[model samples]
Target: MLTRIVRMAFQPEKVADFLAIFRDSEDKIRNMPGCRHLELWQDADQPTVYCTHSRWDSAADLDNYRRSALFGQVWPATKALFAAPPLAFSVYPAGVESSLSSLPASQ
Candidate 1:
């Protein structure tokens, strides 16, 4: 499984517009093939900053969605509202095993 995260900082005045776009497209995005989950989050300290977290079966599935007509429509509109260039990346679980005993003791 792959997890994709995109953080967007929008103009203060454009936040509403971005929300409306997300509202209109969220379902379509969530329903796309290989999409397992979708969520939207706002930064606690930065009201105009938002992030999208989504899970996909694999990177190819994500790339397919990125090339779809839905993305074509949604991204440009979303991009136009950004206060800064968006940050996006994909990752998977490290599958590392660990225990509290491995940690340094607190003073």
Candidate 2:
């Protein structure tokens, strides 16, 4: 399994718009092939900062989704609202660890 997180900072006033985009697309994204999970999180101390957490069966699957029309449409819209380029990275688990508590195993 692969875990991915994207950290984004948006114009404070664009929070609602950003959230609405996520709300409208979360289910579709979660249902995509090889997608195991999807979630949106906002920084408690900095509400304009947000992060997206997701799990994919493989990096290929994630790449495929990124090239798909869904992403083509969604990403540009989302990117336009960002205050800066998003920070994203991937990780692989080494057995069970407390740091991974927030992630569930792929079903």
Candidates' lDDT values, in order? 0.96, 0.91
Give the TM-score of each candidate: 0.89, 0.86
Displacement of the residue 73 alpha carbon in candidate 1, Å: 0.2
Root-mean-square deviation of each candidate, in angstroms? 4.8, 7.5
Reference-based TM-score, model 1 = 0.89
Error in Å for residue 9 of model 1: 0.2
Clashes of each: 0, 0
State model 2's lDDT.
0.91
Best by lDDT: 1
Question: lDDT by residue for model 1 over 20-105, one digit each (tens)?
Answer: 99999999999999999999999999999999999999999999999999999999999999999999999887644445555788
